[model samples]
Target: MNVATDFPLREYNTFGMDVTCARFVQIDSADEIPKMADLFDTPHYILGGGSNTLFTDYYNGTILHPAFGGIEMASQSTPTSEGTSSSSVLLRVAAGEPWENLTNYCREHSLYGLENLTGIPGLVGSAPVQNIGAYGVEVKDCIEKVEGYYTDTMQPFCLTSDDCHFGYRDSIFKHELKGRCFITHVWFRLSPQPRFTLTYKALAQALEGREPTLDSVAETVLAIRNSKLPDITQIGCAGSFFKNPVVDQAQHAALLNRFPDLVAYPTGDGMMKLAAGQLIEKAGWKGRREGDAGIYPKQALVIVNYGNAKPEEICNVYRQVIADVKDLFQVTLTPEVNII
Candidate 1:
């Protein structure tokens, strides 16, 4: 592990915010983590691909980047390790592995669970932190377990799926026990025979009367996302900056009177999932730019950093948009991207 001071983070995050880390260390192997941990006295933030994080200002503490990378196949057995005639597979990936790379590997290997999350950018470890999702699939659906080093105990342990408590772009890692665990690796169970899911409208439309193949689903999702979202290489953006707000049936009905054509999904528990994009667009925020920050014209949910914008400017637009949506529709929108 090599420690450096004042590291430039312009290219580290997809959002393209120019923030500097006071102390930066890259750990490429699990064996190196303990020594690195011993060197840092202050609290640290673990960064993977940096796709999901928003740096509002320069980090004050050490920034630990888990650069470890590898994948292994482990025997997939129940928690009890009972033997079975049918065999499942476990994909063990290092924390720093690019999420897209893992998805591609799964596709190439005929693994079934990650087809719907084709275009999402980030690292594998960060996926569980947010329970990252798209096109009717979420990371929690396939994650068998997460292995990490607990800062408090200074020991490594595995967390079962239920332990993660994944819920709508959130998990135990993000709340209740934030920054307590340094995830070193993750394991997932995938199917050789795919069980395809096409619940999202845009994905369904893209497929449009075709049989759902793994490649087809992935291709369609990629195409759909590429058409709307700005390329991270060109402009900085964390896809779908805010999550769709979930409201009770009564609130949905009340909002329906104001905007009858608003798109919504029934949660089956008497709550409705209203599209934040539609709300933002209706409020006239789409494609609107102030300095280097702007809302993507095609995707109201995506806030873009057009050029050399400060992180605070990006957040200002985010705050303004959320506030407007709340004032107009009486629903509070929560950001999907992690803000630091």
Candidate 2:
């Protein structure tokens, strides 16, 4: 429970940028937050798994770590005329539980719904905040409730599925209400009755036109991720540095005319999803390196901090990519990783 000053953060984030936190505190349980809150006396950022974040510069305030862990299942059922049969089971996960670990746990338990989220490196608490998604499935689809405390008021609250306001890798927790609450736990509704979702192109192709089974989907996703994303252990990188921009139909058509080979997914809401990676590669940025920062060869959307790169160097590359994409496509690429 020691709050250190000017702490080195190179080992804390996936980017491996050597930045120093002005203040740092780590908590292992929710009961400790109240006491820590008193010590904060100032604004702070909650550190989870630190997979989807970039330390552009050192923090000026306290950086708290939510280290809680544990997972529990509860039997849930609804009233019926026939009988009280279990409808769904609630899996309660601590805020600090690694997201990938939770996905693997569900896979091992024969529980469906978390398979598509495989290989996403983050924490249970941060998942809902970003509405983390991959292969056509977002975490919001499986979340039942999110329990957290109001940082300002120091009051605890519970948010149901709808309250999360999840949409396209975003949630209320991220915007409109950012930093207002500190997520402590998350509850998800997973099914033992296999209802797999493997609709994405990569997944479908991996399955070879077969039905979506939990095991197959999970395995396919893991393989795909491993092949695409850089190994954080070897190379410092935050996967998918930029978010795929969703452009309107008019813009999509304009881009299609300019680049006929452009690939996109219909949002079914007068918008089309364009892959940021494809755009980066099309812009001839793939495998490009500048100093210690570089665009990943396999996935241009990722920006890697190769070997002892400073935080500013990584931020420079991000700015360059955004500027280049805007100049070429008239589309602004937004970063998915939290740049702090």
Best candidate (score: TM-score): 2
Estimate, for each residue in 232-308, the C-alpha lDDT of model 2 and write its tens digit: 99999988889889999999999999999998998888889999999998888899999889999999999998888
For model 1, state the Cα shift of residue 163 in Å: 0.9
Task: Tell me which residue pairs clash in candidate 2.
Answer: none
Compared to the true structure, candidate 2 yields what TM-score?
0.94
Evaluate all candidate structures by whole-model CA lDDT and list the values in order: 0.87, 0.86
| lDDT tens digits, residue span 153-233, model 1 | 667879999999988888999887687878888999887766888888888888888888989999999998889889999
- Backbone clashes in candidate 2 total 0
For lDDT, the strongest prediction is 1
TM-scores, each model vs. reference = 0.94, 0.94
- Tell me the RMSD of model 2 versus the true structure: 1.9
Clash numbers, per candidate:
0, 0
Model 1 C-alpha lDDT versus the unseen true structure: 0.87
